[model samples]
Target: MPATDRSVTEALHKRRSVRAFTGQPVDPALLKEIFAAAQRAPSGGNLQPWQVTVLTGEPWQAVKDEVAARIAMGREGQQPEYDIYPRELTEPWTDRRFGVGEALYASLGIPREDKRGRLARFMDNYRGFDAPVMLFLHCSRIMGPPQWSDMGMWLQSVMLLLVEHGLASCPQECWAMYGETVRRTLGLDDGQILFTGLAIGYADEGAAVNRWPVPRAPLGEVIDWQGF
Candidate 1:
């Protein structure tokens, strides 16, 4: 409540997926600001549960190369310990998932039948889509689902903070599927598990992928008034 509601709500609305970015490096001061905002996110039982390893310069590119090399060998050798998606998705969730995928690929002229085309787009996630700053986020083993929810709140805080700084981000859960490799390479403790990665930087405005502004359903569709 420290800031005006309009500014807060407007920032939330303006946050979007920005894939392509110029090669400019994110400054340390800016990163400090973003992380500080991330730190302020609400937590469960006062357990923050989240840890972040940000990569840039040689380290970032090195991890990219290592993963790319593995992928080039036709093998995603290291597997995640848990499932990323439910075995079955039902109801409105299923429709929403499909719609998002359709909208995203449609922006790039990728047809539904083009399996390889879709794979190519996912492959971009591996390269951080050539993003300058890559953030690896993980949660501690001691935390449960509620704590995981807190981690998401923190992630959203980081995303909105980036937007306020004129930067864009993409929270890549798919990146966590390579949790083992990401952990080993990033020197994360074994007790910490990769939750996701965020691609951060100025979005390349001209890129086709950045043009996809996936729509959200109207408020009435998702919200119920208590006593309007």
Candidate 2:
């Protein structure tokens, strides 16, 4: 067994989605430790389905530049091989999604009519949301819906680990839009497909965007206990 600090649990509980990041570099050793934590996530029938490409330093800037260049060209870029959202969102789910969007845009001071502002902010996802570290997560092509669910668990594990390290992470499903180009540029194998990207780094405390706290549904709305 190894020694651990008491701050671990507290960090997990207090973790929040950080939209702004400081330019300071994250420690390589801690990054490695976080990946190790991500690997420990459970999988379906023990078939772990997560491959992560951690980007930093020059590699990160290279990817960022490529993405920006493509955007400047008047291209919508590659579409996701799979649909991120449901064909139809019903009732509470639809309302919840809209609520989150409204809250996020309000925080950024982008009014409901500001389409340009929204697009510009959305583009920032490809730029790692201005975070110095970007993690692209992929899974084998053979994976079905069950494995994708497994992938979500792995992503959650990684995000929690980032929080425990005093770092923040935003998992962007929109990254799949240009992930094909990112895959080819990064020289990844064909069997692997990017499911999402994560921006990880210390939160920029002075940034107003990170100051807004988005509300979450209560336990009663999300949980039901039948066994008593």
Candidate 3:
């Protein structure tokens, strides 16, 4: 079905963090159109602080190779520019995190005892789950929390746009774990901080990793109503 035929709510329901892709390349024109439209996403004071480096073909493969070499050498790549998660994550948040992870592995038939299996599966993230295109999001190092929030909003806009184009994506903060490597490879200066990577392509719908259901908390659990 064409994306234009789907409502926003339908797109939302269809969207998922697709971990496996068919390795099909998305049309460059479509990519440009999607991002151009995403420019309208709201930002405080109209500060369009998001910067994206889209990679495909040789450039993308070079990055995968470099990170793979680092993994093989027992290196941690580089010091992460920022924490991906809070140092003191607690309660229901931690439980939710653990639950999704367990569910993912279970979908792949990997038991908790199979540490190697889990690690191998995780390492596939560096390869971008075989997506033909990867986009690195970055912004000035000096940007504050508000600017960071703007980045998230822009990212959400991009993901929804991808869904509207019959494409799938995975927003990976794990890429930030090797921020320096990515920055250097892309020739981006230290003035900018790499935020995350988004893998975009057609999803491998039949893949077990893509078939698993990712649960979400009930609307009542997250939203509080005063008067409506």
Candidate 4:
């Protein structure tokens, strides 16, 4: 399916953290159009702090190779620029994270006891779930939490735009685990910090991993409507 004029609500409903993608390559012109529109995404104090490097073909393969080599060296090879999650995640947040993970594994038919199976699947993060393109997001090291929040908004905008264009994506913070490797492979300066990677392509909708039902909290649990 090609891009359509979709409503924001429709785009929201269509968007998913797609884990499987077809081999079909996305059109470069379409990608450029979507990203150009995404530049309008709101930022705090008009500071558009998000810096993205879109990769495909040989460049993307090179990054995966570097990360794979690092993975072979074990945990000691990791050089994360920042913590992907809080040191002590508690309560609802922890439960939510665990629930999604369990659901994903269940959909893949990997039981909780199958440690090796699960590990193999988890390692797929480095492959961008085999998506055709990888958008590596980074920002200046000097950017504070507020700017980081702005980056999140920008990412959301991009994802929604992708959905509207009949595309899919997965925002992988797991890339941050190999931050230094990515920086070196891309020849990024020390002042820049790798934040995350977005895998984009046509979704493999028939795949079990892509078909899993991702749950969301009810509005009451997340929203506070005192005025209403």
Candidate 5:
């Protein structure tokens, strides 16, 4: 099948954070087009702070091996390049976070008491869940919050582009934990910091983990209609 045949609204509703994927390879030309389309995302002052490194073929396998090895060794001598989550999560934010996690695990039939099972599954992030393509988003350390916001817009643009191309993706912040490994393995300079990793390929539609729809907060609770 070709890339998505849906309208933007339809794509928005159908897009998901897929955790499992088929090993099928995405055509290189299609990959080029999807990324080129993402270049259209809005940027702060047109600075376009986002930079991407896509890995496939032998390079992708090698990186996956290194990451999995590090993970298996208790992730020793490793620390996150940046704090992925806030130190203090409060109120509805905490509740929402917990709810989504519980929903995901329940869908996989992993019981709350299955610590090992959960942790092992969590490690799949390093393996990209066996997706055929992996991409890392990076930006220079000199960039500020506004530039970081631009990177986020770029990331969303890429994901929507993938959806349009009949592909799926999962934005894996977990990769931030292996910052040093990623930088060294990918030959990234010290000035560049990884914002996140993305796993892209065909989704395993039959997987139980992909079957459940995560909940979202109601608009009334999150928005204020001002002067409308």
Candidate 6:
């Protein structure tokens, strides 16, 4: 399968963090091709630090089972290797996060008072949101912040490629909370740190959870002007 002629702007506008996906499977060959294209992402000195563990079929089932079992035992797996968010998320950042959560729950018809329902739905993330394919991004402990930035670029490339391939994806940092379980389930060594997880498959367009659109700040607010 060749890369699509989809423009970068079009892909950006169309892409979102897809939370619900259908049971349809993505072809392994297409997965390979998309990741290969993602290799084109820039890295420091061409040292691409991103490593991926692809899961499907039985392996995928096993991962879900382990996460569920651990949760059932009243465990949240292990301490995260790194913080998923700042120690104190303040100002507009907090507002942005809160807004999305409210919008998402509203879309699902889960009222603000339904704490149990929200928690149960949030747990679905560990199961890859039932996506047909899951990808776990990993990087070496030896890598520094620069390499982590490189990993982000690589993942973004992969997400855009998924869109080009008529697929949807959700880059999940929530998996980082269960890093130890991911390492054990995937047989990854201590040298490798779990960065994030990506759930990929066709989107469930009819699902209300997928209908919520999170707002972004205006470019003028984020950008700083320089001398022209």
Candidate topping lDDT: 4
TM-score for each of the candidates: 0.90, 0.89, 0.96, 0.97, 0.96, 0.96
- What lDDT does model 3 reach? 0.90
TM-score of 6: 0.96
lDDT to native, each model: 0.82, 0.80, 0.90, 0.93, 0.88, 0.89
Measured over all alpha carbons after superposition, the RMSD of each candidate to the real structure, in angstroms, is 3.1, 2.7, 1.4, 1.1, 1.3, 1.4
Q: Write the per-residue lDDT of candidate 3 for residues 122-146, one digit (tens) a residue.
A: 9999999999999999999888899
Cα lDDT of model 4 by residue, 1-228, tens digit: 466637999999879999999999999999989889999989988999999999999999999999999999998999888888899999899999999999999999999999999999999989999999999999999999999999999999999999988899999999899998899898899899999999999999899998878899999989999977
**Residue 37 in candidate 2, Cα distance off native in Å:** 2.7
- Model 1 bad stretches (over 4 Å): 1-6, 72-78, 226-228
In candidate 5, position 113 carries an lDDT of 100
List, residue by residue over 10-100, the lDDT tens digit for candidate 5: 7788789999999898888998988888899999789999988999999998888777777767848465888888999787999999989
Candidate 5 regions off by >4 Å?
A: none
- Per-residue lDDT tens digits for candidate 6, residues 1-228, read 555638998888888999899999899999988888899999999999999999999998888887777677665445487999898999889988899989999999999999999999999888888999999999999999999999999999999989898999999988887788878899998999999999999999999988788799998979998995
The worst-scoring run of ten residues by lDDT in candidate 1 lies at: 1-10
Which ten contiguous residues of candidate 5 have the minimum total lDDT?
1-10
Residue 175 of model 4 has an lDDT of: 89
Report residue 66 deviation for candidate 5 (angstroms).
1.9
After superposition, the stretches of candidate 4 with alpha carbons farther than 4 Å from their true spots are none
